[model samples]
Target chain A: MLRKLTVLAAAVGLAFVATSALAASTKEEPVAPSAPWSFDGPFGTYDQAQLQRGYKVYREVCSSCHSMNLLAFRNLGDKGGPFWDPKYKSSVENGYVKAIAKDYQIADIDRDTGDAIKRPGTPADHFVAPFANEAAARASNGGALPPDMSLLARAREGGPDYIYSIVTGYHPAPAGLTVPAGKFYNPYMQGDLSSFWKGDPNKVPVGGFIAMPPPLADGKVSFDDKSPSDLKAEARDVSAFLMWAADPKMEERKQTGLAVMIFLLVFSGILYASYRTLWRNIDHH
Target chain B: MTAHTTYEPKTAIERWLDTRLPIVRLGAEVLEFPTPKNLNYWWTFGGILSFCLATQIVTGIVLAMHYQAGGASAFLSVEQGIMRDVNYGWLIRGIHANGASMFFIAVYIHMFRGMYYGSYKAPRELLWLLGCVIYLLMMATAFMGYVLPWGQMSFWGAKVITNLLGAFPIIGKPITTLLWGGFAVDDPTLNRFFSLHYLLPFLIAAVVALHIWALHVPGNNNPTGVEVKSKADTVPFHPYYTVKDGFAIGVFLILFAVFIFYEPDALGHADNFIAANPLVTPAHIVPEWYFLPFYAILRAIPDKLSGVIAMFGAIAMLFALPWLNTSKVKSMRYRPTSKVYFLVFVVVCLILGWCGAQLPDDAVIPALGKTGINLIDSDLNSYVWLSRIATAYYFAYFLLITPILGLRETPLPVPDSISKPVLAGEAAKKD
Candidate 1:
């Protein structure tokens, strides 16, 4: 009985060591990117006009489905303006949207009838949704839940570039390509086994495709002649605007990080010197 | 001691370091202990475990700087930190997350080393108990830390564990509600858990100090079961053990760096990437890998209270181990038969961990279908049977086998003298 127990113990130990060794030996494979089409470029530095165009696209098309719940309406006129151009701040004050205050009261309008007065738009007022609830919204758009765009630029894998590409990538179907049913296909999206395909080769970029059909038609939004004035250019402009919306303080953070790094470098030198001075006499007999 | 009798001019820096870092002398004394000559690589795990603990504390502090504990802002704050906050904030968070896994890896090895060398026996029982306490505290700390991120896994994981309290016959729902700080896990629960997670590491550190103190009292138990009989039996710990432990720490740090730099998120759950959504439930829910063994024990019981008791009992049982074993023998080296039982116990533990990771239904089919026997109708019931059997074996190794084997088993011949020369002479004469 003792011998049997001893053997059993040894076998268990051997098994554990062997299994651990096996686990150690099998190297894990690298994870592939979940989204295939990515925008590759430096994140910072975008043209001012492009941002203006993006705001227009967002206001007209994207705003119907997405809500930037965290943003206050009045913030549009801030230094980095989405509602007003910095160069033409005066034009913003006289624009169609203006702040107004009113009191609720019924007064005689023509001696025979009295009516409650109506109020104008205010900076404090939030953008009203087209649908009352999620069910109503879904009923209008084939049951697909539209994600909030407040942080969409940051949440996605490729930040602004992915958004830009997805917007401009939409086109009619090309020759020799068959798209399946129920699934809207994007040629650029790797690992997408979806069958729905739409896009013409002339309209779409070689590696670009998106489920969202072309949102910007040619000459839809006018920009300065030097700026990207086409639909594709407008798509890129709006993507940049969304990126800024997602992280308004990004530039400030980067600047602060640089300053802190410099301070740490100087501080660490002093600390190292002090540490050496403190330890200098420790070896004495 | 007299070698430094002659006064010599000291460098200014050396004097300054000595004044500020006074603990260096005590550290030197610890490093210089006269360890048994037979000490090997396994003994290095204790030092490596300490290193991991220190790493965790530093990284955890950095992560806490940007982390918001309130449910309203917690998930958003983490995302902001990853996307736009401090530079390399994502890397820092990932390192801390993976560091918890690595710390467990080291402690498990350290604990196993103690068991294998019979370091928990006799005078060192308190040390072993201290270690077990540290392990328990570590589990609680890690569990709470996971919830602080407020991701999908974080929310669901917290809900599932807290709900386990509801399994109790009378006080279950009330207890769970109290734990959650409301009807469900929300801002209040997250806040309290964050506070506790921050506090527990220090508690663990204190226990670890006690563990080391206990260890020093009895010294380390080496591979050989024989006690030190003469001056030749051990070497002074200073230069000898210090260099060995230092070298081992360096090697261990290299491995730690590989994980930290190259594959920081390898150990983390993918579901944690998505923000917490109360409306959407993940298809599969599982605890972190480190908790798998106890999770298996929890699943074993059919009754809610019994399962809770059994899970807690599994850990509590370890405390009574020193007293429970009937075996007189301290080390497996001297007990040929008992060693086999010890190995079998280790396998059972690994099997339980693997089973815990599997879905309950998948685990049940094999047990019933393969054997063509229905010992229990529910998979959980079978798990309970398996755990009970394993738990029985675990205690039996200590309570029954050790004392019994010590008295009955004929041990291999042991050398009488510590010196190799003496043993050599004896061998020559026999030839």
Candidate 2:
């Protein structure tokens, strides 16, 4: 009976942790529900089909506001990238990537005229910004700056999970909660809503007001593969794409990690055996 | 000295060089040095630390080649140029970043192992002091290294940590100004930090050589804390310790590799990915996990000057440990009471690290969190009070517990020599 009671107590404690963690952002910020991403564990690799769909979400929806200044057209076809092909050893030489690069206009200097000109982008060109500068972007978006998406997946605590959660986490403001002008309620966001809350003093609600309204909706970006294009799907795809942008070397890192781990383990075994053999003649506890 | 001199130069060329340098003889002496047979796995950390230092130096040199120290470009150089554009730059950068954390892990264990075995006592006091100097140099190196990326955390962390000197009266402001090279943490500060970060590692290497020299003078402290009375109590440094330390290092490298590859950013802050913006500040700013205990101690006191003093005092406690511990019995193995206290001290330090990461005003027990029973400004059940309690215990463990326990506690009867326990067990088995 005592053991059963202990087990019951443990279960109760674990349940309490789960509910409290997900229910509200007390001082502990709300944890994003982890999505099953293709790239998560040590052996995990990015799903190319999903990444391709993800690029569509970024280009069609997210690109109008957010910028991926660090990403180049060549990067889209680099080894382990979405458009990568074994046939094209160099990402710049990939025909698909070249075509994609040619679709966009890149800001360039006209060599002869020495004047700024917009020309067809090459594979080497970086992704262009939606707005010319931070001020212009802020002015266009209700005096709130849209953060660059180049490293956004990495900048947040939960990475892609946090991005997915925020994009899909919008909810109707609780009756007692007050949202400031041009702000939307997101349960996944981190903030203190005590002043804005008219609810019970003990219950100030989870999450905070975000400047960006819900950007993802059902059928937001129709995928080429005819995959699901719901709010969650779009959010998940875009989050994955951003993750690729943030950590392009993850595949190589993981692969090298496996080799290093194996070598270390085998080397350790040899060393341990040698240590045992060397100490055999001695008697030191 | 039954063995003949193995390193006596036989060749004419070797004999000609031996009188002038004899570096080969130095190696021979080091490899053949007598070490305590009973030294445990804890002794392996010194070897592991040597490896850690070498890893940091090599990886750091490569990272410096590619890293741009300018404030505006530092983040880009790291995130885009190195991580993406440069070949295998991600691997190099990850190893260097994670290597710092690994170095601290090994050093902390090595230091605590010293404390538990009372390796800091008697003739080894200077040795302990040298080790302390190396630790100080490591922290300085790490702090400056963290500032090089010029990210949000890098900028603000540098700003906050440098401002710590300003807690001192009179000379504080000037020192802070001199350190920053400007009124704020900007490009100039980044440049200077990059230079110093490169410089401090070499200084750590120098101090490490001295640390080893000091160690060679006294030899290693054993688990029994009994001084070597005979040759039977010791073993040669080669084959015995070499293989043992090598095995331990292999194990340490596994952990280091896991962090570098699979979990590269696990030890780092996400805020560091964002470029430094002077106008914007992160909601909650905390130091790296390694510095959390000191951070906790700093915040435990309400007054800024007192907090700063208390934080530095935490490290000063380490230097004063050998003198403060009054026990004739060195190792905690003999002192059961001290063993318990030592365990508590370890836990207290961990609790202090947790406290550092948390908001001071947050409730210690979440159930009683915002009760508003303000005991001197904040809630009675808050982390602030918990931290204060932990800080008090942290000091008391060193200042009060060690001296008092040494005098009062009846310790277990210790063996006369390192080999006594081993021989006694063998004798009992024979009977």
Q: Candidate 2 chain A — worst ten consecutive residues by lDDT sum?
A: A17-26
Docking class of 2: acceptable
Question: In candidate 1, how many Å is residue B326 off?
Answer: 3.4
**Each prediction's whole-model lDDT (CA):** 0.62, 0.86
What pairs collide in candidate 2? none
DockQ of all models, two decimals each: 0.04, 0.39
lDDT string for model 1 (B1-431, tens) is 11211222277765676678745445554665556765656676787788878878888888888888987788777765553446677557656786787677677767766776677778778989999999999999999999988988899999999898788878988988888899988888999999999999999999999988787677777766555566566766654555555555654554444444433334555566567878878756677777777777787666668878878877877787776655555557656776777778777776666556555544334434444355665433344456556656655665677567657777555555334423455546531
- Which ranges in model 2 have alpha carbons more than 4 Å from their true place? A1-27, A31-34, B1-6, B370-373, B422-431
Runs of candidate 1 with Cα error greater than 4 angstroms are A1-285, B1-28, B82-84, B169-174, B363-374, B379-408, B415-431
Positional deviation of residue A207's Cα in model 2 after best superposition, in angstroms: 1.0
Highest DockQ: give the candidate number.
2
Report, for candidate 1, the interface RMSD.
14.3
Interface CA RMSD of each prediction in angstroms: 14.3, 9.7
